[model samples]
Structures are given as C-alpha cells and as structure tokens.
Target chain A: MIGRMAAAFAAGLMLATPVLAADPPAEIKIGTLYASSGRYASISMPVHSALKLWVEQKNAEGGVYVKAFDKKVPIKLVAYDDQSNTATASTLYNQLITQDKVDLLVADSGSVLTAPAVAIARDHKMFLFDQTGTGASFFSKDNPYIALMADPVSTIWPKPVADFLTHDGPALGIKKIALLYSTNEFTGTQANAVRKFIKESGAPVEIVYDQGVPTETTNYTVIINNIRAKKPDAVIHLGYAPNDIAFLRNVNEVGVKFKWMFSIYAGLETELLEKNVGVKGLQYVYTYVPPSELDYPVNFGMKMPEFRALWNKTFPDGKVEFGFNAVAGYTTALVIEKTLSVATSLDQMELRRAVFSLSGQLKTLDGTFALDETGGQIGELTPLGQLVPNEHGHLKFVAVYPHEVATGKPVYPRP
Target chain B: MPSAIRHLLFIVVPLLVVFAILPGVYENHLMLFNFVVFLILAQGVNVIYGFTGYLPFGYVGFFGSGAYGFAMMVMHAHASAPVAVIAAGLAGMLIGLLLTPLLRLSGAYFAIANLASSLAVLHFVANPALEDITRGPYGVSLTATFNPEAAYWAALVVLALTLGVVVYLKNSRFGLALQAVREDPVSAGMAGVNVVRMRVAAWLASALIAGLAGGVYAWYVSVFFPDNVFSGTFSIFAIVFALFGGVATIIGPIVGVLILYGVYNLIGFTTPQYFQLIYGLLIMGLVLFLPAGLVSLVTRRGRHVP
Candidate 1:
C-alpha cells in the first residue's frame, strides 16, 4: 500500500511541472510613440528617453522576470516618431498593434498626441499605457483599455493649488485673483477645475480677471499689461514649458510684477524653465513640487537619487532636461515590468487586469500608484509649492500647501 | 477602348481593389485608410493646381472645416456618420465660397491669402469664447458614432469618386478648357471659356473633395483636436504628393502617393530616429533631379502615360 501511494504522488508532481513552467516568448515587444521635433518635443523627448534608458538597463541585466513563463525575457522597445501630428500618430499606433504586434502599447507624452491612441487602442482591443495625458475626457466607465500612468488627471491636478488659495489665501490678503491659461486640454481642464474649486469654496476671494490665450501665444507683454490693469493680488498662469518661459520672460521684459505669481512648468520642467527663463526670472513663482524635488520613498524600482544619477550619466549632453516627465517615463516602465511579472498570460485584458491589480500596491519615486475606477491616477499628487531663491542664489522649492507636506511658508507679496 | 474607360479599368479599379482587399492581407487598416485619405487629398490638389494653375497654400482649411462640420453634426444634431460626412463636404464648399474673393489676388498673393484664411478659421474654431459650440481648444470626442470599418469603406468610396472627377478633367472638353484658362486666362477668355466661372467651379470641386476626406477621417479616428485636422503638414504633404507625380494626368497623383508615401512609411517604421532627415533629403533629391515629376520620364520618351 505505501509503494502504490508513492507512485501516484510522483505521477501527479510530473504532470504539474509542465503546467507551471509554460513556454515563454523570446522577447516582450513594448511599442510607443514620441515627438522628436515640434511644439510638444520639449515634454515628449524626456519621457521617451527615460523609457529607453530603462529598457537598456533591464536588457543589460539579462531581462525582466515573467511569472507566467517562470523565466526572464528580454524587452524589445519599438518606438516611432509622430512628429507631433495626430493623423500620423493614429496610423503609427495602428501599425504598432497590427503590424508590429507589440505586447504593450504606450502613448506619447501629451494629451494631443495621446488622444488618437485612446480611441485606436479601444477599437483594436489593445491596452494602452498612457504616460502623462491628463485630459479629463479620456477617463470614462465604458473604456477599460487605458490608465493614466504618471500625472494625476487634469480635473484634480489643481486641487492643491485651489485648496491653498481658498483655505489660505484670505488670511494672506489675497482678495483678487487673475487666471490666465493656454486654451488646450491639459491646462484648460486644470483652469476649469481651479474655477470650480474656488467657486464651490464660497471664500471671500473673487476671480477679478479670467481669460485664456492661444496655446501658441509667445508674446504676452500685451496680456501682461492687460492683467496688470485689473490689479489682482495673485496671478496664475497655466501653460506648457514654452509658454511659461515666454510669459515669465515677457513679465520681466515689461518690468511688471504682480504681488504673487504661479505657473505650471516652473516646477514640472524646472531645468528647462531655468535654462529658458533664467534663475532670477523664476524667483518667488509658485508651482507644483514634482517628485524629483520631494524624493518620495519607493517600494519598487530605483529611488529618486539613484534614478537621477543614472539619468545624468546616461544623458551627458544635456539636450533633454530631466524633470517630472523624466521621472514619469521610468515610472511607466516600472509599471509595465510589474504588470508583465504578474499577468498570467500575454492577452490584452489579462495585461490590463494585472496592471489594475497593482493599483495602491506599487510605490516608486513618483509616489503611490493608485487609480480611480475609470483608470485615472488618483495618487502621486504634486503639492502646491513656491520657488524661493536659496542662500546659494539658485531657486529651491518651498512646499506651501497640503499642510502635511509643507516644507516652508510661502513668501507672499514678492518684492 | 474609350480613353476614360481605359483609365478607369486600368488605374482607378485596380487602386480601389488593392485598398479594399489590403486589410485582409496587410492587417494595418488605419495605414491603408491613411493611404486612401492622402490619395484623395493629393488628387484634390491636382484638380485645383493642375487644372487652374492656382497654388492653394491653405488647402487644409477646407479639410479642417469639413472635419468640424462632421463633428458639429454628430455632437449637436446626433446625426449618423454618413450624414455628418455630407455636412462636412458642404462646410468645405461653404468656406471655399467665402474665400472666393481670394482668387482675385493671383500668384503669391493668393497663396498667402489662402494660408492666412486657414489660420483665421483655425483660431475661430479654437477660441475660448466659442467653447460651448466648438468645444474651443479642448478637442472633440465622438465615440458614439465610432466605426472604423465603415469609415474606411467610406474613404474608399470617396477616393473612387475623386478619381472619377480627375479622370473627367483629364479627358473631357471642360478639362481642356480649364487647362487653357490656366495657361493663359486672357486668351481662354477671348476663346469664350468663361474663365471666372471655370476657376470657381474647379476651386469648389477641389474643396468638396478635401472636405469629404476630412469628414471620413474624423469618423475613422473618432477623436481629434482642431490642430489635428488643420495641421499645415496635411496641405504640405498633399501639395508635395500632387507635384511629385506629373499633376493634371490621372495617374500622376496616384503614382506620387504610392511611391513617396510608401517610402515615407518605410522610413518611419524602420529607423524613426532618422525619419525627418532622410525624408527631407529624398524630397530635395526629387526636386533637383526630377523637376517635372516622375510622369515626365515617360512623357519625355514620347510615350503617353494614361
């Protein structure tokens, strides 16, 4: 009786071994798009380059681990240039799905370029790993193939800023506000959120001057003069990197300064903004404090210090700036790696499930990876902060809002 | 065989069949759809510039207008894709009519004026004050009527119709008269060709073609911003493609789209890092070596090219 039982157990073990060790693919194909040159290049290149760097690093380590196959597999990154053209992006995205048959589909950096991928991915039933497209319209209950990887959704991005204004502004004598934004989806949605939050708060503050200029507006001297006429206590300018550079430069050139000022890119792409607007121009400007500045504790992937060092070593030329977008790209790569490790199969829906399962569980340099029901990122929120010149004469972030993360008091009424 | 029939059987039919059956064999239907869109746009450029000798630098204005026209119909009226597409064509024609005065300025002036007119339209559609209607710069999303297969077939049908128009221009007396007007408007007027009327007709027809292409494109993509449809690259590509083929001929634009666009996709897919540099060099080479376009090669040999 003992000999017969041992034979049955040995047979069961032999049958289960093959099922546990499934055949692995030779390489995991991750496809994505980027803008090499054009308006969006400043934002797109850093994200794409960071992703490329992660791919090279992993492949150097003999590849990432895949749980389904019980082995490590090399990563093959297939990227295409959209040239910042949506039609071209649409066609290339389809090629990635149909022709290249990439295992993972990642979108370009911004909302305009990523818009085409949102629809195309759904049509083809391919899951899209949206990098930093924070458009509010992209998230809906019907679409299950996408998730925001890095930035918070635009609708909620202005919460900390708005919270600072409504809760803290009345005491600081910030009675009037001026809101100026570039009329595009990312900034426009943030602008809307700011307006809603301020209105709903029922605070004593009022938006004295509210207007939107074209996204391509380079000369803001006239707009600056126009805003000065309103005499608002605090001025908020929402725009991309180039817009911020131009707006800040114009304010300095025109020799006008409001008591308080805010701009998005001043904090998000600090390196690029510093190079363009100069150190003196960004002094006392309020903006979001990115992860690179905060150095959030990580539970997975490289820590902020290590990632920054690797980035500096890899990109020695300094053509592309390292900022929030650089961190964003690597965060996305980490998510992809984790997803591949947990997914039971290479199927599209299975990949999505694995990605969603990592929500609230994965932590990296970008902060906790959390998602709303519609796949919009709810965690990794950047707190409102002010750029104050340090003793070394270089601008340093002083987190002002969301009391838990406050590093220093805001120096309001800039001299 | 009759000349028009021969051109239709040999050129148009084969092109249509290839695009129709390509989705099954080639898998990338969006690329195929884009090919068809470019083919129609190139031919549209051929119609105006080839037949009337007017270089419309802002031809994408019509395309963008058509796209918005389709969007408005779908978003506000809740019309189906086909109806919205027709509205798109009408919108293009409407803009063409509105800019009819631009034709009065000939040569470089007309081109610049057309370009300015397009930019004006772009700003108008993207203005924040009009956000309630056009959605301003926030963009439009029409997933309710999203049908890629249907939109692809619609694009194919539009391509066929555009080819028919071009073939008619290549063979009919109206075409010869339009060419005469292009060569010398005074002489053509002396010969009783109704120069103004002929120019306007060709201009409207060209606008209609682009408008239809834009509508079909919007339907296929189902989500876009104003910048996507109004991109100056569309106008530039269509003009380059039309000029690269020998223009005026039925096969010239077709050949241009096939060869130039094919090389474009090949470069874009293989080595995307050097895509812009390589494509720029290729265009420069074509301009320097084949000034009259590829059709000139056969025409220079004294052989008729369809």
Candidate 2:
C-alpha cells in the first residue's frame, strides 16, 4: 500500500510540473489616459468610463479569449488623469508603456492630446486605438501603430457640406460663400480641406471672404461685420462646441442672418444650445455629424436605443448626456473586442497586425471600419443634418443632405 | 554650522543626490521630473516674492516664453539643446526687461497687469497668423532632442544654480540690501542702495530661473502646446507652495514642494475636485493659523532652520 501511494504522488507531481512551469498573467492589462479635471474633462471622462464599463461587462462574460494563451483572460484597466494637458498626457503615456506594461493602449480625446501618444506608440511599436483623435497628422506613414477607432479624419469633416454646396448651390441661388474657422487643429484642418475641395470643384460657387478666428474669441462682432459686408449667400463656420454656440449666439445678437448657415458641433450639443440660444435660434443651422435620434444600425453589439438605455442607467438625471464622444468611446470598445477575437496572439506587434488585418472587414456602431495602411479613415462619411422643429415642438437634428441617410428634407433660405 | 555649509549640506546636496539617484530607484521618472520642475518654480517665486515683496502673478509667462524660445531655436536655427536652453534664459530676461515699466505700478495693479501680459503672450503664440513659425495653436514637437535622462540631469544643474543663487542671497550683503529695498525703497536708496537697479536685477534673476526651468521641462516632455506651458496653474502652484512653506528661506520652498506636491500626486489626479476642496481648506487654515508658513513652526521658537 505504501509503494502504490508513492507512485500515485509521483504521477500527480509530474502533472502539476507543466502547469507551474509558466504562469499566465492574471488579466490582460488595458492602459489609457483621461482628461479628468481640465478643459477636456467633460468630453474625455466619459470615454474612460465607457471603456471601463466595457471591460467590466466583458469580465462578467468570462473575459476575452486569447488563442495564444488558450484561456480566457480578464482585463485589468489602468487609467491615468492627463489633466487635459499634452505634457501630462505624454508623461503618463510613457509611464503606461514602461511601468504598467499595458497590453493595449488607448487615447483619451481629440488630436491635441492624441498626437503625442501616436508618436510614442510608433516609437515603442505599441498598438494604440485612438478613440476620437481624428487629426490627419496622427496617421502618417511614419506613425502607423495607431488606429482611429471612431470619427472620420478631421480634414474631410467639411466634405459633406462641400458636396451639398456643389450640388445645391445653383438651384438655391447660393453662389457666394464665406468661410470662418477656429484656429484649433480640428477646425483649421477642416477649413483647409474645404478650401482645397472648393478650389478644385470648379463649380459656379465663389468664396467671397475667408478668415481664421481664435478659438477663445467670445465676441464674433468683428467677424460678423466682415461677413455682413461680404454678404455671402452661404456661411460656413467650422469649430468645436463652444465656438459653434458662441458664434451662433453672437451672429443672432448682431442680426447677421445668412441664407445658409452651416456650423459644426452646435447641432450635436442639442440640449446645451437649446437652453442657451432657445429652440427657435438654432432653426436651419446645418451641421455634419448625425444626431442620436438617427436610425443608425447596430453594426457593433449595441444599437442606439440600447446605448441610450445604458447611458441613462449609468448617468441618470442627465449628469452625462449622450453624444458623439460617448458613441465614439462605446464603438472603440466594440472594435477592440472584435480585434482581440481576430488577433493571432497576445503580443502587441501581433495585435497591431491584427488591426490592419481586420481593417476593411469590420464594422462598428458608427459605420464600416475602412482604415488605410497609416490608419487614416478612407471610407467614413459624415451625414449632414439641419436643425428643425420635430413633432415634440423641440429642435431636433434631421438628416437632410445625402439622400441615402436623410431623415427629413432640408429647408433652405432661412426664415 | 556656517550658512553656506548648511545650504550645501541641506538644500543643494540633498536635492542633487535625490533627484539624480531617485530616477534609478523610482521608475516614475516623469513624476520625479515634475517634482523637480515645481521645486525650481517655487524657489523662483520665493526669489521674487519672499525676497523682494513683488508677487509675480505672471511668472509662467517667462516659463512659456522660454519653452517657445527653445522650440524656435531648434525648429528655425537647428541649434543644439544646450545652446537652445541658453537662448531660452535670454528670452526670459528680455521679457522681464520689457515688463519693467509695469513695476512702477505697485501691489494689485502690478499683479493684474502682469497677468494680462501673460495672457497676451499666450494669444500671440497661439495665433494662427504666426503659424508659420510658432506652429500657432497646433503646438511644437521636439522628439529629436527628447532625451529624458539628459533633460533630467540638465534640470538638476539648473536647480543647483538656482539654489546657489538663493544661498548667496541668504548669506551675502546683496540679499540684505534687497530685503532693505523690500522693506523701504526710499530708505534703501538713502542707504546708498541703487533701488531701481537692484529691483530690476532681482526681477531678471527670477525670470531667468523660471525660463531655464521651462526650457528643461520642454525637453523632458518633448511635446507641448502654449496652454500646456503657459497654464496659470504653474504660477498658482509656485506661489502657494512658496507661501505654504514660509519663503525668504532656502529650506522653505523645498519642504513645501515635497509635502504639497506629494499630497497632490496622492489625491489630485484621481479626483481633482476633492483635492482642490481639501487644498482650499488647507490654504484657508494656513492663512488663518500659520500666516508665516509651515516653517514658522520651527522658526517661531527663535530657531533658524537650515
């Protein structure tokens, strides 16, 4: 009996030897930066929360499955506050790469903060999924490790409006155009793209006046005076939410009405604009990005209704509003999940290869993921919308341009 | 112990040793780098405010100017990092000289005017019309000169020079004359002190310190925007740190940075609003109780702390 017991123990020890030889990591580490308390806090904090929620939800469902490890690995997320400063973002990113040893890296917000991370990601050969950093400079041939998860390249943000101008200008008797854009990277890039596009279009449309305004310019009186002097039939304002709202309020106060007033970011900030400028003030103000009410398909795991439900549940009493930032965050998580499923191994280099491998084949809640070698979005097109009163007597963004995505017909020659 | 020996042992040597060696032991080099920056800036504030009684509300202007100066040299001149850092110092002195006219306005007027000057500089750098040179609001990238270790040591060297100046001011008669000017410019002038000249010198020295700190900071971070370097938080933090530790002393700013910046890292990043609340309460308590700063606890009993 003693001899038999000894033999059985030896056999058990042999079985456990292979198991103890290599210890698998407790969880797959996902590291990211968040602008928790600075200028970008409102926009970036939600992205971090959404990413966290995705990880928690995945962990509940037995975590991500890695073929290389041949096991389900739970995600351990390490996030740092960047204080909405690029210097802080770069430092924290370096920490994430070196100290945290994160398996996957993600960017927080727009290109200003994301550009440094893009450079670092390329240098380290780390896979970076940029959530909303759509600056065209972020995806050069030199910096190819990063993939913009959502939002089209900022350069082409004005393309839909350009298309609208080229197609509808002659019929609407809108030929003269005035261009005003904020000096910010996103706005400036869009303004330049629009200028190039219009110059090359050879349409009857003529740009009367073009100028770039500082992002912090609260009073648009001087620019409004210039625009009134030019008397352009169509005025295009490309800027962020604050710039858009401020310009709208300033133009309204100055009584500088245009036949066609197109502004970016204002239409998406429906609640804030309505409260600040009133519902009637935003009527006929056109923008590029689609609003939440649009019947955007559930290409990723969550649809619009489900996303709204999750958003309301997570942030009740309108503490956090649902908008493009939240959608981009959610879509980024879905994309990462799909990428993980397709990746050959858990290695960072292999994961980058996997992102490129599944580029055109995948689609998210936003739209089809068509990224080129440098990770710039080549196929994503923003739907143009005009603000009009809906059945509820509230101003809602109705997709007007591009017949394929138009929820309602656009009203031209503002009242 | 002699004051010079005390400063060398307590202030200078410890900072050099710790900042140099800590990067090896502590893998968080970025955090350490920031700590060094705040230390230099706080001391720079002490030089202007604690020694001369002139509060520089726009100290970050010099710092931001230095950062841009460094970037411009690299981008336009293709100058080496060390050469660019020297130019950055000169740039700060130039800004200081330009703002000397504002010194005629005393107290709150000077503070407000100084603040406006900083904002003006920020707008100038961030303007799109100057995008050809300053890169405008798009910011500057110096990845080529981004050697963190080299920058870290260079920062230590700057800190050493800053502390050396402070130590001299504490021990030498020039510092006593500056204190006299702070107490009464008319009396200092009657006592054969060149009040205007002394004040200008101190102002330029303060600017030089901040400018050098900003230059090293840009090199360390490698990528930043106008808002990043010209943030009002730098001025606020430097002033608060100097005041909290009881300035006019070498050990004060050093101690303030260690305790407060340590607390900041502990709680400031995760939930900043809460940290801001706590810090606000602490500042109120400090003003009410320890008006002379934290070092008063040691100095109140007729004891000199280093």
Candidate 3:
C-alpha cells in the first residue's frame, strides 16, 4: 500500500508540472492586400509574385531570425484580393486587423488603395509597411505607424526630370514648355511638383500651356491641336502607361516637334515602346530608369543580374519583365526581414520603433533604406534614362542624366 | 396567408433577420455590410428592370452620386449622417430626373447612352478642374464620420425599406399597371394607365434605393475614389442577381444574393479569373435553361412565386 501511494504521487506531480515550449513559432503571420483582379492586376500581380518568391527563398534558407523571440520563424503570408478598389481594400484591411490578427500590414499597390489603410493602421496601432503608395500625403508626423518601404514619393519623382530641363533646356534653345498630366493623384502630384520646382528654381522657362486631362481621355486630338498651337520648345507628360501610350501615338501621328520630350512612366516599358515606336521613333524620348535597370553592385543580398536570373527562373514566361515594380516588392520584403531581426517583441509598437530605427542603417537592392521622421524615403533616388539606338538598331534605355550614373550622352533634337 | 404576408414572413423577415443578427453571430462586419449593399441594389434593379422593363446599364451612377452627395454634405455642410443620407437619396433622384429624357429611347441605345452619361459623370467628378469642390481623383475620406457599426445598421434599415417597396410592387395594382406598360405601352394607355408617370416614379424610386445604399456604403467604408463607387461591376452583379433569382418577385433577389454572393465571397477573392469563368458559365446556363430564373424551377407549374 505504501509503495503504490508513493508511485501515484510521483505520477500526479509529473502530470501537473508544465513543459517549456522548445522551438520558436513555426511561422509568423504576415498579411497584405492584393489587386488580384480588375484594372491594377497587370501591375500588382507581378509584385505579389515577387513578394511570394522572396518569402519562399527566405523560408528555404532556414527562415528568418526574430530578435524578439530569440529564434527563427518562417513567414506565412495571409493575402486578400482588394480587386483594385479602395472600398474593398478598406474592408479587407479591417478583416486583416480584427479577424486575421496579422503581425504586420503591408499595402498592395497604389496610393488610392493604400491611403485609406493609413487611417485603419493608425486606429489599430498596427505597423504598416507601404509598398507602392507614393503619395506625399501618406507621410505626416501625426501618423508614425506607417512606413514607406518602396517607391519614392511622386512629389520628388519629377525633380530629376525638372533638373534635366533646367540645366539643358536653355543650352538646347528650349524656351517654351507644354505640360500635360493625368488628373489622377499619381500624375497630378508629378505635375504639381514640376510646376513648383520650375517656379522656385527660376530656370528662365516659360510655361506656355499646362492642363490636366481626364485619366480616361481616349482622344488627345483636341488637346494635341491646342498644344501644337502653343508651339512649345519642349513637351512633358506625366501619366500612366495607357495615357502615355495614347499620347505618344497621337504625337507620332500628328508629327509634333519638340527639342526635348520627357514622359514619367514610358521607360518602365522599354521593350513595348521599342516594339511600338521603333528605335527611330524613340529618339530623344526621356524617362526615369528604375533601380532594377541599373547595373549597380550587390547590396542586401540582391544584384541586378542575380535578381533577373531568379525572376526568369520563377516566373518563366510572366508578361511582366523584372523592373521597378518587381524590385520594389523584393526590397520591401528585405526591409521587413531586416526590421524583424532588430525587433525585441512581436508587439506592434516595438516593431514600429525597430522599423523607424532602421532609418540610415539599412541598405537594400534599391538603395540606402533611409526614411525621414514621417516615413518618407529620403535616400533612394531614381536615375534618368533616355531611349537611344544601339548597334543592333533597336531602342534601349540608356542612363543619360546626372553625369555620375549616365551610361550614354543625351541625344537632343531627334537626329 | 396572403402571398404578400407569406413573402414578408418567409422571405423578407428571414433575410432582414439574418442581416440584423449576422454581426453578432459572425464577426465579419465587412461581409455583412456588402450583403446589405447588394440586397438593396438588387431590389433597386428589380424596381426598374423587373417592373418597368427598362434596363439600367449605368445603375451605378445613382450610387456614385449618392456617395458624393453624402461626402459633400458631411465635408461642406457639416451635416449629420442621417441628414447626409437623405441628401444622398435626393442626389440620386435628381440625377434620375436629369436622365429621364434618355427613357425616350429604346433598348440598346438607351443602355449605351446611359453608360456614356455615367462615364461622363465619373470624368467630371474626377477632373482636377473641379478639384476645389469634388477633390478630383484624389478620392474622398470621411474620417470624421467613420463608424462601421452605425453604417451597417443604417444599411439594414435601407434594406428593410427596399424590401417593403419590393413587397408593395409584388402586391399593388400600380405595379400591375407598370407591368402592363412594360408588356405593351399602347395597351396600357388604352387601359387608362398613366404609363409615363408610373415609369418615371419607378425609375426615381430605383435610383433612390441605390443612392441610399451608396450613402450607407460610403459611411461604412468611409473612404472611396470615384472608380470605387462608379464601378460597372455593381450594375452587372445587381442585374445578374435579380435576373438569376427572378425579377418581379420579392424572394428571387434575396435568394440570388444569398447563393451567388455567398459563392463570390468563397472563391472570388482567392482566384478571381477562375471564379469569373465559373460565373460566366453559370450566367450562360441560366439564360439558356432557366430563362425565368431560379424561382421558375419552383413555380414552373403555374404557381405564384411570392
């Protein structure tokens, strides 16, 4: 009887004692929005695929280390399609916050969709990693929870374009400027930035005509006639791909002459522009080159060659070639991983502080990952590129501005 | 029980009950809010297309106008949500009145004209030339009146009112006259029906319902670009739901929404292309086999649908 009692007591004690958790969490749940369908799908789908690829690569390499848990945890992405609609994006964001209980919130695409999420993230006190949203309004001292990880603000995008015109316009006898921009936020911001810079810089430039056209403007004939009447020395367009393509085709058909021509989003599609406009047609057409096109040395585990190789392997035949959008997505994932390494806890506040502390300390494939107090990217700068003919008689984007990054000289006055 | 009372008990009450009780039973407020929106929109479509035989291709015009109406009221007039919603309904009615002239045209022409008008409105609202007033393409954010709970309940109230209207249409002599006008305007005129007035009234009422739904939607989500509210998908879904279930009946749209929207939420977001393909096939099948809608399957032997 005594022996049995002792054995029973020992078993009860063993059962009552708690067992320590041995390994780190199997995965960290990261939630993001996606425009899997609708208008923005063509641009957003590739970025999302690249994001998945980055996460898969990290998991393959034994997962990412979390300083908070002092352990390695693989990432698990919980994504919802917003259908490229702002309301849907807002609704999905609420779900991500209240139901999914995501550890982090990353934006899908565009300022229009992501802007509403800023309020949601602030309300929930969740750390938001903004990807493609480049609205200057997104950054403010009032909301510190949001951080811009990819794409420079649109306000600064036109600065380089303006700088080129300011320095080279007079020398090339370019006196008058005609600026037309889409009415959407992205193009509107660029237009405003250009105006502000020109007005402040006092670059001896006369703005002959400036107007904002509807984003869905299919016919540019009337506008083109008005612009043709203006007889400007230079013409600059700030718009999306479709708008740019339509305007370019119209200009080509109308035979509008300009000493200089620059468009914001045209360079993103080098191959398409080459195919549509041809090498001769593209002469003197200027655009800003995305970081992915630059032959920069490897930084933060990514180089242009290696990134392209991986992209080809992963997508195989994706309609989207590796460019700004893909590189931005990959860089965003790297920034998230870097933040996780420094975070002391999974708590949103701690994570946000860690991200904020990464201001000038981190470097990624894009450039130095430095952010201002309001979460505006202060370090990364895009290089300007102009379409020039190669030996093969094909149009290729050649870095042409800001002498240091210039791969070829600017060929002014289409010859 | 009378057919009207039967519908109220079996269809209307149950739907209202489900929507009202859903927030507590299920924590997905966004999903529930969307249900209220579609319910109101589907019933709105039934009012015009089902009864008056006018296909409203740009039905989302009223919705977008209402959303902007509510936002402008709150932003400029500092009006309360209730007041804004009233303005929203008025906005839709006003736009409907402006578009009443298009009713003179018949069939595809009217549809094309209506679509063009809606697109024109979208461009006008989104134009930076009007930025000072409408905020242009930058979108509107009603952070001041951001209350999902209130918006959800308001949406339910709108649904209830819409259902009441559907019930009235299902049972009233005026509705019968509208149907007569839809079948043969000359015959309805000969039968002493005020065909023009009745059609206009139904058109305005349809616009009002969608407008109110839009107001509540804006209130619920609290932020939207012009594209968000003016999307053609709303018109397509509402028409499909009404057509799929059976127009002219109270239960059809409700049933259509519950089944089709349920499927939409299940797989639509995850794999939209596949879901779209499936949805297209189903719509085609419905048109070919079930011409009278899903309700016809039950009411095929000369039985009344609701």
Q: Residues A87-205, candidate 2, lDDT per residue (tens digit)?
A: 56776787788788898999878877786686567656788899888776566675557888877887776788887887767678889999998887778778878888888888899
Per-residue lDDT for B1-306 in model 1, tens only?
Answer: 999999999999999999999988998889899899999999999999999989999999999999999999999999999999999999999999999998898899999999999988898888777878888888888989999999999999999999999999999999999999999999999999999999999999999999999999999987788878889989999988988897888898889999988988888888878888888997898799888788999999999987
The best candidate by TM-score is 1
- Model 3: per-residue Cα lDDT over A338-373, one tens digit each: 888998888888888898888877777787777888
lDDT of 3 by residue, B1-306 (tens): 787787788888888888888889876577778878998999999999899888889999999989988988998998999889889989988899999998898789988888888888778888877767877877776777877788888999999999999898889898899999999999999999998899999999999998898899878766667777888888888989988999988888888888887877766456655766787788899999998899999898888788
Better of 1 and 3 by TM-score: 1
Model 1 DockQ, alpha carbons vs. true complex: 0.69
Calculate DockQ per candidate and list them.
0.69, 0.29, 0.35
Every candidate's fraction of true contacts kept comes to 0.64, 0.24, 0.31
Q: How many residue pairs clash in each candidate?
A: 0, 0, 0
Worst 10 residues of 1 chain A by lDDT: A16-25
Flag regions of model 3 displaced more than 4 Å.
A1-23, A80-100, A115-125, A136-145, A218-222, A295-299, A372-374, A396-409, B1-6, B269-273
- Runs of candidate 1 exceeding 4 Å displacement: A1-18
TM-score of each: 0.96, 0.91, 0.91
Per lDDT, the best of the predicted structures is: 1
| RMSD vs true structure, all candidates | 2.3, 4.7, 5.0
The deviation in Å at residue A102 for candidate 1 is 1.0
Which is better, 1 or 2, measured by TM-score? 1
